[model samples]
Target: MTDLLTIRGVSKRFPGVQVLTGVDFDLRPGEVHALMGENGAGKSTLMKILAGLQPADEGQILHRGEEIALRSPLDARERGILLIHQELSLSPELSAAENIYLGAWPTNGIGLLRKSELNRRAGEALKALGCDVGPKTRIGGLSIARKQMVEIARIHAFKANVVILDEPTASLTDAERDQLFATIRDLKARGVGIIYISHKMDEIFTITDRITVLRDGVVQGTLATGETDADRVTQMMIGRKLDAFFSRAEEKFGAEVLRVEGLGRRGDYHDVSFRVRQGEVLGLYGLIGAGRSEVVETLFGIRRPDRGKLWWQGRETAFPSPRQAIDMGLCLAPENRKEQGLVLGLGGRDNIALPSLRVFSTFGVMRHAREQAVYLTYRDLLQIKTTGPATALRTLSGGNQQKFVLAKWLCRKPKLLVLDEPTRGIDVGSKAAIHALIAKLAEDGLAVIVISSEMPEVLGVSHRILTMADGRLTGEFSGAAMTEENLIRAVAHHAA
Candidate 1:
């Protein structure tokens, strides 16, 4: 197989940061090349250069043995290159056909719309990926998986030779991910080169033909997927052996801080009963749609439980809103961090201080000195990489953004903390850091409840694990009983 694209000596520098340095990468026709790296490791920079979203300060991009200058996104697209970002760029109000042919809609003479031709062309593209969705269906009504397929269909419509999929399976279910893998195989059969960027080790090993590791704005090495293991790849990306990535410290739990009895929220969850102790790390594990989040939301007062009782510090209580929960020394870090957890346009100091502003305020005026002191404390503790405290939260990488979210709640000094998918979309190093932080917080006598879909995360950080299924607590395991097989069985077992 001949090389379809070759990148040599790629270097990019921002105002205050050097992104990529002397990087060399290549791709062959019909091959899935995996780009592996931690947050801020120049993977995104290299891909942006390839997609023409950004220019390399010094490098040469060769396509089909000919050097090409991709000065703009349109220039790259004209040469058969397409980049599908992690966040899908589909218009919600438009139908599948309209979105696929957005700027290039077929028009009759005199600028008249040719609806039939648009649908036919869109349908042909979708069918090529084994998708049966009607072209007239609205994009917003489609699942995340289907939306991704539509994006791939657009690539096919453009006759793209090189496709870049950034974190394609980040929000997909197991079955939907399998469908996407099938689609990728089809695209491979048609000789399309795929540049896959992901933090997921399993997906990379499963779908990619080769893996390229990048760290600290430089290339670590590129290895054949069949010849490498996850540990080796991880070591290359982080520059250290992660033998104890999931290690947990011994903990001695204190008195019960929270107790729930017959917690039921109409259609959401029912008969949920659990006890969280001080200095305890409780892990909640279950398949998606198993009411793990709903239970936490109800506990945090996001939803009212029609028939239930909560005992806070051994006293019966009710939280009608999140403010009430926060007042009662309980806080929740939601799963969807972008939408619910952090204010993107705001700076790190503003976000971390938002929840605990009262502490840094006098006579309804914020004390800038106090706020800065607190912000600087957490910035160092969490190792958040940012230009400054005033830098926009959106500018931080996923891992750093997550750390700021944790800092926001940690500043409040909550008695009980609920973390939902705390490590989702973060790199391996960040995941380990968050896991260690969770264990440390628990060891410091803070009651913590972790809700995660990753088995290793739950097993490694939690002193005990609780399994939920169909809106109810099904099983509890600890110590030697918290194996992956046991957890899966507990989640899979359906109760009458």
Candidate 2:
């Protein structure tokens, strides 16, 4: 079959960064081609050029063997190209049908709204995707998974020939992800070429026919999926093979630092209990809506618990607010880092110092030198990549952004640290670094609780593992009992 789209000699540059360098790629009809790379490896830059969100400094694009210029997003869309961003792009206040037919809603003879026709077409699109979401339901009221389905249905309704999916499964449950895979197969059968961009090795291998690797704004190589294994692709992505990526020497545990009993929040979680000790890493494993994050948020006092008891530092305590929890040496690096953890407009120095301003100030006066010193300390320790401390947090890649979030809390020297999905959208290289960091933090006698959707990650980093299902603790494992099989089984144990 002839290639559907071709990109040759593509390159891009910013003020002080060369984002892409002479990148060459192509896509064939009916193919799921994966674009794999580290956080700053130029994947997003290339995607932006294709979507006409930005112009390439130097490159040539061709469609059906004829040169083409995509000067705007409309040009790309007119050519049957669409992009689904990692951060969804649907209006919250609008209903599902309205979002699907947002710009080009059906109209009558005098430009009157044709609500029935719009709903009928939207219902067919949703039905084709096997989604039961109500056509008139508000987008804000729907789950993340359902919102994604609506996005896909929008693309389907447009009959897009080329689709770019960036980190599509980052927030989906296993069942939802399976349904998405089925949809992808259907699209592939219909000859819709897909540019799949993700950091997940499993998804890439499972769905893609070809794998392409980029490193530091350059194309490394492309390989047929059936002929290449994950280890080889990973080695190409990071310039080296990862051996025992989660290997660590076991450490001895200290005295208990945190304990929760009969924790409950109506409609969120119930009867959840667990304990964390000094110098111990406790792993929490569950599906997306399995109450893992809700339990942690309650523990950090983000939400009031209906019934529960918490013991901190051997004293029965209640944290009615996050400030009280932080004052008690309990801190959390939340799940959604951009919205909940960091201030994007602020510089690295400011974000790192935001939570610890009290320590650096005296008599209501600022101490720039002390703040800089602390920022530099954690920046170097975490290996955060940036031009300087004054660089905006949004300018950094996902891995470095995550490292900064860790720095923001690590400088406070909290007694018990809670991490929710620490490596959710980062690359394999960054994941290994975080796994190592978790082990080192435990060795230094800090109590840590790691909550992850990936079972391998939980098993690799934790000294003990706890599984939750339907808002309750289902199983606990340690030593020889911690296995993927057992974790999967426990995660499926729903409440009766």
- Give the winner by lDDT: 2
Kindly give the stretch of ten consecutive residues in candidate 2 with the minimal lDDT sum. 243-252
Candidate 1 residue lDDT tens string, 274-385: 9999999999999777789999998888887889888999999865588888988899999879878999999999999898878889999999999999999999999999
Q: Would you estimate the TM-scores of all the predictions?
A: 0.93, 0.96
- For residue 30, what is the lDDT in candidate 1? 96
Can you list the residue pairs that collide in candidate 2? Answer: none
Which sections of candidate 2 miss by over 4 Å? 109-112, 247-249, 494-496
**Model 1, TM vs. native:** 0.93
- Name every residue pair that clashes in candidate 1: none
Relative to the true structure, candidate 2 reaches a TM of: 0.96
lDDT (0 to 1) per candidate: 0.88, 0.89
lDDT of 1 at 376: 98
Per residue, candidate 2 scores C-alpha lDDT tens digits across 1-496 of 7788899999999888899999999999999999999988989889989998999999899976778999988888889888887767899999999998887799999999899999899999899888889788899998877888888887777888999999989888888889889989999999999999999988999999999999999999999999999999999999998986784537688899999999999999989888999999999999888899999999888999999899988889875588888878898999989879999888899999888878889998889999999988988898888888788888778899999999989988899999999998999999999999988888999999999999888999999899998888899999898998889888889321
lDDT of 1 at 350: 93
